[model samples]
Target: MYVLEGDKSAASRELLSRFTAPYYLLHGTDGKLGTGIRLLDCGDMMITMDVPTDFEKSLLRGKPAAVHP
Candidate 1:
């Protein structure tokens, strides 16, 4: 499985953009936790694991993700 580990400060949009592909961005919607993040799609399919947060349930927000597109 592809894992993105390291300090958030070290992670940048440019670096993440490199993963974009001509087709679908597979292995995306897998699993994640911690602070939320954003996702940019090139009409690709993203896979994410179910991680409904308690905060979201009470706050009426969406499921939290390491990234969100």
Candidate 2:
């Protein structure tokens, strides 16, 4: 898996946007204890965002990612 880790900065956004294909931005929903990170898998690249607060969550709020078993 291609993991790209960074904060939500201009550089991060520019790097994340390099993937031209479709992807999903995954985040925690409060029920499950996670790493407090946001992930996006665009087939080739896996993007991750560190979101550990309510403000951060609100800032990154967008479409939900569907995880299958």
Candidate 3:
């Protein structure tokens, strides 16, 4: 797992503020390693969380697959 060095909490707050949509900060995930915090873009809005690798994979799995000819 890649760890981003520096003040992640402040950086995360700044990132979240850029979006116009409402969001809930999952503070529990702050400062946790391996479970990197992320800003999820949901087209109309967004979400922020710090989930384990398996949960992260599950989130990706929920997305629709692209088709290639």
Candidate 4:
């Protein structure tokens, strides 16, 4: 998970810390919102806590395979 906040909330920081997967805090010359949007636009997939359990399940399933010629 890549967070786009200049400052994270205490609860969000705690939650992210508990995750074994790598989480990044993005800051760029483009600014936080622009950076986040760019990441989302370029990213293969994105998951949010709207359904925490389901998101966890998807994460546990791991990254998808890439096909090559």
Candidate 5:
């Protein structure tokens, strides 16, 4: 599971630290930076963003092929 947020990093970090699922993060130019700074108390998380317009293009790359989008 993952989230796309402009701000609220601290909150995200807090939640991510306790997240029970494998997760990813997509931090974007959503005009919320300060909140993001507080969310770094975590690992197994990184940011690689695809703006909503390009979502389908990113998902077509090769990965484990058993699942369908």
Candidate 6:
């Protein structure tokens, strides 16, 4: 799995389009509770959820690794 900041680039999209295996993209967004989790896509399969604020906190317990553009 790859954790990247910002939106997916055109090149990245193009590369994923050529893959036969499934791919999952998760994006963070602002919501009433706090940070919102968005399941961008899952190749042929599709799934989504609005992660609870508490759950988000648990998911990010450790110091985040800096993501360079």
Which one is best on lDDT?
A: 4
**Candidate 2 weakest ten by summed lDDT:** 28-37
Which whole-number lDDT from 0 to 100 does residue 17 have in model 5? Answer: 52
CA lDDT, every model vs. true structure: 0.35, 0.35, 0.34, 0.38, 0.35, 0.34
- List, residue by residue over 1-69, the lDDT tens digit for candidate 1: 132323222223333446566643535333344322333233232432232323234333554334323
TM-scores, all candidates, are 0.24, 0.27, 0.22, 0.37, 0.23, 0.22
Candidate 3 lDDT, 1-69, residue by residue in tens:
222222344434443345342334332334443334332222322333332333333335795322111
- Clash count for each candidate, listed in order shown: 9, 0, 0, 0, 2, 0
RMSD of each: 12.4, 12.0, 13.1, 10.9, 10.8, 11.1
CA deviation > 4 Å runs, candidate 2: 1-6, 22-69
Instruction: Tell me the tens digit of each residue's lDDT in model 5 across 37-69.
Output: 334335333542212332333344542212111
Query: Candidate 6, TM-score vs. the true structure?
Result: 0.22
- Maximum-TM-score candidate: 4
CA displacement after TM-score superposition, residue 37 of candidate 1 (Å):
22
Position 43, candidate 3: lDDT: 35
lDDT by residue (1-69, candidate 6, tens digit) is: 222223344433443344334555543323332122222343432433332324323435764323221
When sorted by TM-score, best at the front, the candidate numbers are 4, 2, 1, 5, 3, 6
Q: Which is better, 2 or 4, measured by TM-score?
A: 4
Candidate number that wins on lDDT, 4 or 6:
4
Better of 2 and 5 by TM-score: 2
What is the C-alpha lDDT profile of model 2 across 1-69, one tens digit per residue?
Answer: 122233345443444456444455433223222322222323332443432223334355763422222
lDDT of 2 at 69: 20
Candidate 1: list runs displaced more than 4 Å: 23-26, 29-69
Clashing residue pairs in candidate 5 are 9-35, 9-36
